[model samples]
Target: MDRLSQEKPLKILVVTQYFWPENMRINNMVEGFVAKGHEVTVLTGQPNYPEGKIYADYRRDPAQFSNYHGAQIVRVPIFARGQRSLTLALNYLSFFASASTIGSYKLRGQSFDSIFVFGVSPIMVAIPGIVLGRLKKAPAFIWILDLWPESLRAVGVIKSPRLLGWAGKVVSWIYNRADYLLLQSRSFDESVKQYCTRAISEDRLVYFPSWAEDDFSGAAPVASDLLQRDDSVFTVLFAGNIGDAQDFPAIMEAVKAVKADLPVRWVIVGDGRASQWLARHVAEHRLDNVLLLGRHPLEKMPALFAVADALLVSLKTNEVFEKTIPGKVQAYLASSKPIIAMIDGEAAKVVANSGAGMVCGSGDALGLANIVRSMGALPATERERMGLLGRRYYFEHFSKAILFDRLEVLFRKATLRRSDK
Candidate 1:
């Protein structure tokens, strides 16, 4: 028999609104599957994310079909994610409508062993996977990165109890239909279990954590101007989306509190709705120590981390946020950089358990200032040791290779169970 025929390969269809070119974990997951001899296909929308406009090449003719690496990619029409709430809502709903209609027609004839939905925000993205799974007789698996209704409320996106109730029903419907539900944080177990019906057993629920990209392990060369750092000061860097959930106002307060006393610099590297506001705040306050470097490509992260004295992660105090771990935590750990977790609950626990760095309550400006001072006072050797511990913890638990292995087994189990049914 041919070597390729020695073992059967899996055919997986990934349903996600964001994919490659839109910095998402699903991109790495799909690439990993293709590397492991599994056939993969992605159904996603045009690449307009944090920035409300579509990318250059995709703008003119937004091709319906494309390929990345070895996996097939199917793109669908979607409204530009304009900053306004109406346009944003349309962007989300348009992807679902277009994907459902076009995806059904395009993928109906193709057979898949498993259908995987990567749910980051707006859980309705799973609809395509559920429909395709039923049509193709494949098991549908959902990896929940963000919980609905609760998340919407936490973000102040929807407030009315009646609206929340309807959203809750939609969530319950999706949960009931999915063959398997993978959660990123253990704290999410209870909330997710409450929605599980008699048809879905506890055994179908699995704790799945996101891991850092493989590229973050080592330093990569970056533009010198991108560094934008004072080599003498103790730098605390915050990288990723700067939004309401990040609780950047608290971070700004902390920076203001500490700048007068300590020789520390606060650097924020990313963009979002809050970017302009943050820039304005910094300008109005004339805070020279706080630098907003805007956004950079993913490839530059390693170099950026290499120069940083410590990495900062923060979230607003909310029940939903407490049960979630921000994806940047893994990247911070993988970079072998000491972290300063300014959040509560599960994420704080992860930093503490890993022996990576210090933690403070969310929105606690005074508490954050104190931790910054304490970390600044620590010896270089102590900080280096902490980074090493974080890196060790990452490889032992959250490395992509390890998590991907577990994911492959989960896919096989879901497929096997569906066949038995």
Candidate 2:
């Protein structure tokens, strides 16, 4: 049979707390599904993400239900994520509550072939997917982006052993119930298997890494004014969340160590809880070479990438992070920019394997500084060659087309399993 005949189009409902207007990889996945002739509906919260506050327009009720790129989006009521940890926890719980209650009501009569949960943070988000999947007699597929409890511990969120044990039980419950688990890193398989029961077959666990969104594929000419950099200076750009996990202090130290000798500039292009502290630290240290560009819209990322010579990615030294691959690595590879990965595990391995960039141990400021100086010393053509190789690797392994093909097959398998039961 032909591919389409063998794998029929599916009605896929994506459950995610974050979506469009909030620049997440899930947006790309939903769009890809729609492009493949599948009916896609998104159950998500109002647009309030990296920034704690919701957008002004979305604060109104009319913004709750809308269609984007041919996918139906149903927004539930969520407590706005304030800057405080207590508020953030409330924000997560509120979404879990609303998504389970309101989502069940909204999707009561709807039938879907599979419930795909974009599991990034707070595994609690999977509750609705699990509930709805059971209700509809469909398979629940969870794409594990961040492993919970361990992730919480890594970020110093939940330190108590009792709380960790409770969280682990909750995680194991979700894993046991999930019909399929898609992991972003190969190393995640063992961690997931540890929690899964015999009822959850090992074959259901799959290694499925993220891909750069369609936008990052091509080069866009950036206006010089937007970058605020002279053509003479080499720029090493780091984009995405500036949270505790990123260990930006180490990056700052690396910049400080090399500033006198290399004359390269460091461009940080995102916002988070740590943004204010990073800016203040730069000012306090008189680090003129470091420029905090603040948060820009997702559309501007291509332009920003155009202006950058090298891309930087970092994570704190943690066992949890060692098995994790930061999503931005795919984007950096797609941008065809040589990477400097100061992350000690899977992310670093990816960069090294792709021959796209150099890697240093996480939080190793001196080692990162030396790598920076070495990258600066390399010939422009050599650096460009590295970037080209990275781009080739991205297309070969992490392209959207490759991901979509794999997901199509997985969806077919999930639906087939449901029917077999």
Off by over 4 Å in 1: 1-6, 60-65, 218-225
Which candidate number has the best TM-score?
2
lDDT of 1 at 225: 55
Tens digit per residue, CA lDDT, model 2, 1-421: 2433474579999999998888888988888889988999999998888678987767675545478789999889898898898999999999989999998898878899889999978999999999888898889999999887899899998899999999999999898889899999998988888888556666788889999877788655455456865567779999999999999999988988898887898899998878889999999999998889888877788778878889999999999999999989999999888999899889998999999999999999999999988888889899999999999999998988988888888888777766767
158: Cα error in model 2, Å? 1.1
lDDT tens digits by residue: candidate 1, 315-384: 9999999999999999999988899989999999999999999999998989999999999999989999
- What's the lDDT of the predicted structure labeled candidate 1? 0.87
Candidate 1 lands at a TM-score of: 0.95
Model 1: clashing residue pairs? none
TM-score of each: 0.95, 0.96
Residue 129, model 2: Cα distance from true site in angstroms: 0.4
